[model samples]
Target: MASGTEIPAETVAGRKGALSTVISIDAMGGDRGPAAVVAGLVLSAAELPDARFILHGDQAVLSPLLARAPTLAGRVDLRHAERVVTMEDKPSQVMRHGQGTSMFSTIDAVKNGEAPVAVSCGNTGALMAVAMLRLRKLPGVNRPAIACYWPSRNPSGLNVMLDVGADIKAEAADLLQFAAMGTSYARNSLGLARPRVGLLNVGTEEHKGRAELHQAYAQMSAAASAGEFDFVGFVEGSDIPSDRVDVIVTDGFTGNVALKTGEGTAKLISGFLREALGSTLLARLGALLAMGALKRLQARADPRRANGGVFLGLNGTVIKSHGSADATGIAAAVRLAHQLARADLANRIAARVASTGLAGQDAAATGAEAGTAE
Candidate 1:
């Protein structure tokens, strides 16, 4: 398919209804290949009967997969692409040579308004590079942040955090923008009317951590009312899984490390539990008694339930699923992308950025002004 070519809605057979939501998928991006991607679509189709997909990948490989899955027969429109962006590909390299790649084409569909959202399990850097190149950033957004749902004790069972490896460094003004964007996401996605926001720090004390965080704290406090979120001051890393804050804002470096560490820790705990449960025949009998409760706990802590990392501050919604996501994980990501797209998350972030007034001023100047104003 040509870049930016518009595939008419009539071409998709199962999407004649007016309420159907269209999603573009990078079929060749996941580690497990097109089969996993197609399987995910099938799972999503079973749950979301009104969802339609525009799959971009090699026709030869995807044709047989789609044929086997009768559920997606009329709900999908295939857009063939010859290239694939590997995990090793750098963002700059992909930018220059990724014309017809699946990742690029998937994002292009969203840019052309053929789909409201695009989901890719491709290289994070390459996906973001292509998305920014094609869809561009929303007005007044100096930098785009990647926000993800973290399972927590909130009523919604999740909290929003941003800049999880989208960029390593952020100024005080950027942090404030992340807060605004995160607040909008939490409100729209999690159904929070007034989300509480926090700045991640080494210590919860006002005087702890770097100068930029202090500046960000002051700015967030000043803009919380206008941004429609409550500023909860500084929160330590331990507060991420706590219900005290609904949104946590941090630079990409810290946020990415924390995210990986949390994932690792969850896996470690799961492994320990499995070993302990099967340690003896008596323990196995006890495990059978507790199987129902264990299942509930597993479901609650499942990483697959929170699969997509939303690219905030973009013109269109782009969800970056984990590269190694299985069918279940991909389905979770698809559901998230659909919800955000249906809610018009891009416009919400844009409006929040405009209201917070973080985008208009220079980063350094905004910090100085915020300090003076406080």
Candidate 2:
């Protein structure tokens, strides 16, 4: 219903409370479908006493899982939608004729105010397309970006990265907006007075890539000078986890690769250590003594903290977990959404967009009003 057809407002509505908002989940959207989603829901209920869920999917397919995970069924309500959009479903098809699908309905719940956020693990492209089409943008936002949280080496806090496969090709202005948007997120959610923002570039130089880098460099520098954020210049992939920067901005394609590579490396390292320790008696004894340390490291290495991606720059809060997310992973995403909604992330972003003159008009508009203070 949100369209660029209308002019951007000078001010957007304030954020609602997390406890005041409900989470709508598509139980049949992931690799394991309702079973895994149900397990996650049950865990979520225990962790979040105030936040509830509205499961949108085929009740017939979910009934058995519902019985198995009685706690979730008892706590959360259900809304049936006879159809589901699978991982393999064509995005174009979903974009073309997926009106009655459960994923759409789940999102519709948020649009209708029945839920504050929507979480799903199915058809990334379809979800992004649908959300963009339905929720629209926050005035100045060109294309909605996806953000994922990375657990820093320092456990005290986490780092955030955005455009993780949302927009493969990004404009310089878009990246700058993304950085500003990201900074606002860190400040609002992590309680930072001035969040450090970094552009994902090959090097820390002012001029890096061919045209794209040069263009983005100018915009980012200007935003920083304008006091939009504590812009920390360019950061390489290696710098993402060093905790040197609070927000790392990149295009979706590169961000997605980096995300997947990080996960793959973690798994590889864990497996390698397991095999190496089992190969010798001394190593086995060492492993026994260091089991707790190993487990802790493994947990730290996990990308799940960064696994659940947030669709930033949208009108409403929508968190998207990995398409192959497990029960615990999904639970974590729900919890993060709870925190974000409670943190008033949407309202904060809206305010930033309004104050900084970001959300001036939906790009789709041919003649949206312009030239305002915010």
Candidate 3:
């Protein structure tokens, strides 16, 4: 039996009749516990009128939290979980003994057809492990990826990047798969007809980078026409948030480092801006006059506004939200999940990969030497 207390069949049936889409959420996996989760749900419920949620967590802790938010009534169905997978838990341990946890319950709902997508603000490694174990990889996927929205100067105001941290290394064929998967993501999430793809390298010159990158470059170039994307050859780190490319493809180690670096740099810049704005009377006066513009800038740079990193290349969609996310961040993650679920992104990615035959192109060379991801 599943560990959590199942919602009564009558209740679920009634909910299914009323709601257009169901999103399964792990209520206890976040650092803020169920309070932030329920609060975020309240926000999501208000924005997504036709959506309902299956919240998994300790009933004792969640019941009161939900009671405090009257707006969430009838929109949320709580499942009682006896335990939680903590940030400190190893992925291996969680995979073996996480059946009773809220995180596992969250993924199981999607696996059982109760929800089309699952959202969890938990340990990234553990969440990926559990999700892969339960949902399994999509056909022709070797290493699943975590794609995130990067603020960019594109018309859509965003770009897609993949393998943020699903695994540390990706072979040439894997990078090829990432490009195809990212193209599908941009099409669905960013509404791009044909997104521009870029391979991360030390320079724009194709001659640079490791041997695997050279192979990936050729593969991406060859596959771009069939994949329905524009391969921009190679891009530097500066191009990540630029309009020059709509998808920045890299191995997980480099991607994860770049992600954290970008986040830290954003925070640092915000702090400097605050300090400079308050440094003198004249600066303070100028700040007041530009408050509206400043607010817009802050909104654009806010990490919480772009909180979800989607786990791509899986049979089912899973959103890995920031572990320390507050209500606003959690709401953003939920909204992203809702968007992807509506778009049927997973199957689209699978179809894209299969169509291009990217997954099977280099099967015999899967174990060959590749670039040093670190």
The sequence of per-residue lDDT tens digits that candidate 1 reaches over residues 91-181 is 9999999998999899998888778789999999999899999999999898899999898998889989998988999999899989988
By summed lDDT, the worst window of 10 consecutive residues in model 3 runs over 365-374
Among all windows of ten consecutive residues in candidate 1, which has the lowest summed lDDT? 365-374
Error of 2 at 39 (Å): 1.0
Instruction: List ranges where model 2 is wrong by over 4 Å.
Output: 1-19, 154-157, 225-228, 357-374
Candidate 1 stretches with Cα past 4 Å from truth are: 1-17, 356-374
TM-score of each: 0.91, 0.86, 0.91
lDDT of every model, 2 decimals: 0.85, 0.73, 0.84
Summarize candidate 3's per-residue lDDT along 7-103 as a digit string, tens digits.
2222134355852568899998788878998889989999987678999999999999989999998788999999999999999999999989999
What root-mean-square deviation over C-alphas does model 3 reach? 8.4
lDDT at 255 for candidate 1?
94
338 Cα displacement, candidate 3 (Å): 0.8
All candidates in order of lDDT, best leading: 1, 3, 2
